[model samples]
Target: MRKMILPPPPLFSALQQPAQHLLPYKTRKKGGGGRESARSSRRPQYCRDPAVHNALYTGDLQKIKSIFKDETTANLIIDSLAEELVWSAELGLWVLAPQKTHTSPLRITVSRGYRDCVKHLLLQGADVDAIVGGKAALHDSCANHRAECTRLLLNYSANPNILSEEGLAPLHLCTTQESLPCAQMLLEYGALVNQNTRDRRASPLHVAAKHGLDDHVKLYLCYGANIGHRNREGETALNSACASADKPEEAGRYYRVVKRLLESGADAQIAGRKNHTPLHNACSNCHIRIVELLLQHGADVNVSNCAGYTPVDCALHAVEDYLEGEPEKLIATLLNHGAAPINPKMLKFCVLSPRTMEVILNTYDRILSCDSWVEFVPSEVWQEHHVFYDSALCLLNQPRALQHLARCAIRKQLGIRCHQGIAQLELPSSLQEYLSLSLEGYLK
Candidate 1:
């Protein structure tokens, strides 16, 4: 290599001597120690010549090769050549010798879809299963919805079902990215639809349902994916779809799939970690139509989970317009069909009413304070003084008042009864308190 010394600094000769003298005096006064010389060498060197990286950055690879013919320029330009090569490769604009960052030259081409690159790189001996960023290159192509690239890669023996670092396979990646074309291609290429991730034990259907992708869902169903396959938590994909109804577009799609799943005989009663079924999940999200669809398919509405929350409880917890009174309607339907009521908040608050009080107190084994029970009254009802009986009335077990105690709960749950017989009853203070909270929480 020919040696070339960097040119010496040009001088302002008249000020140079004076500046040198001033430097020493200023250093002492300003605390600028001689250690500053070490700092000067710490910064990176910037080569200002545009010709060096310009061709590479701009994808002018032919021009770049010509510049490299001059040995001095090549030596100066080598530092930037790798970046130029990588950028050009990523852009699919030109070919170059493998640079440092990509020493193995796994050429899953960066642009022009996934197909041609797969064919080209396969001929060049690129590894089909080479891992990049903890993902197989097949995942990148599929997730970007590159159908042809995915197909070509698959033909070259890439694993179609390998899980990425995120525990997502090409199927899961396609669902999340909403790439219907790539997902369809994956299925065509023998990708497993019911494949489970160890993390969620969630199948490809579940991933699609969670994100509410309609076409991915349909593709899975068409390919004989078990729509009822539950995750590790025992929740099915339909359950996820019902619970994740965040947007109208998603909600509508979820409903259509739920209808399809039901018609196809997928079970709606499969429970999750807390023993919550699809009905419970729908109620939690306040989807009246979904709740109705679940019930129409013979779902149990009053089934309580391990945490004492029923589909009724979940529905009552929601405040959306269509969701109002859903839990009540479902509960009523189930009750008519012989479902027994569970321990209720009304019973919890009504200690004086002996009818169901014994049963309620027996379940708890101890009285939870009057104040605690009183707190169950909705804030709106409490502010309105709906439950105003004397402290003495609460002291004794009042059995005759049982009919009266049930009134508030009935009214709060079903709305005010207009019948003269119902309006005639004098509800107890405890019962009224129960009514207040139930109504407040429900109305809210």
Candidate 2:
């Protein structure tokens, strides 16, 4: 497959030759084993001549005025990373590397939040659309959260949708709280609210949800952003929110994003690349609150992904400790929502989670056998929670208690409406709790 190459912005034409001259001229070696020998494996260093780089990076307005006296000097591309050390696999050694990145003075000033220098550069004829390192001045300013610089550049007619080298639009680069204002400015200036990245084809909403930026998500939705837009992987913003969260502490924020997306008519049942629904992702990631919310919003409890793994299968595959609270609550919720029973052999996966095992056991009236159930439990976990497992093992081949039998019958009768049905039942609190499959961490 051929990769599409984006042509550099027309603004780059002004700096191509002069930028090369800005590089510190390397003097030739005089002796055989002298300069050339030393240079063969040395890094090319960028010299920050006070007259040029000093004024730009430090926001020295007077110095910049004196240095960039003409239009040509104002557009001279500076070398930010002239050289670096990188591994050379063919040579089997680390080598000094020269990278080609013609950074514009406008990019440097705006990226560093040097508003005065940036304004002066723009006034002195700096091309606001200049492509530096594959990103325009607007992208650099927005990425660094420089609101003032961003506003100035936008006022100068910077292209809001210019694709960076990585194919991310300027709006896609706004991934932090500080970048919110920049995003707003871009939108106010007519940035495409539903524009997607060239790589992931992910809209700004997908990026916002994946990063748990509730404010950004809200802002995008308010601007008529597509709630059901899927990325390259076919994941909607809701799917991205559930699947991309990596920290347990961030669950609350992602929850809000999911709720907002759902409230705005985002499809909770939208399947992504692997045929994994939002519920499947929520279960796999052990997000109990999200799992319940998704289910309550009509997420399919028994739908399987492309891998033939149902939401229950995903729950079984979750890390016991990662569920934040009781892992059994989720299993119970699935069972109440009409999820299929666990295969006896798969009970081995729950041995480490005593409460979860109890919940699954209570849903069944009786087990036909106990040999696999007993052998599947690891010796150490079994020893650690002997009280729970021992009691559970005892009931393996025996008939369940009459009370448990009644609970199973009621649950089976209620079926899919079991969750809401039990809530309205005029039963005692203990009975209501029993019907809801509340965890006792032990089999009765």
lDDT of each: 0.54, 0.79
Tens digits of per-residue lDDT, candidate 1, 1-444, equal 122223222211221011111111000112221122222111122232445334433445455455444322222211221322222435655433422221111222422353443354455444455444356667777667776777777766667887776787878777554488788878887899888886989998888888877777778889998877888888888788877874544567788878777887878888887888888888776666777788777787668899887775665455333333333443333333323443445443333222223323322212334553554545564445433323222533433245434543464344322122233458665643443322221110
In candidate 1, which residue pairs clash?
114-149, 115-149, 377-437, 378-436, 378-437
Off by over 4 Å in 2: 1-51, 82-87, 90-98, 321-323, 370-378
Instruction: State every prediction's TM-score relative to the real structure.
Output: 0.54, 0.86
How many clashes (backbone atoms < 3 Å, residues ≥3 apart in a chain or on different chains) does model 2 have? 0
Question: lDDT value for candidate 1?
Answer: 0.54
Q: Candidate 2 versus the native: TM-score?
A: 0.86
* Deviation of model 2 at 70, angstroms: 2.4
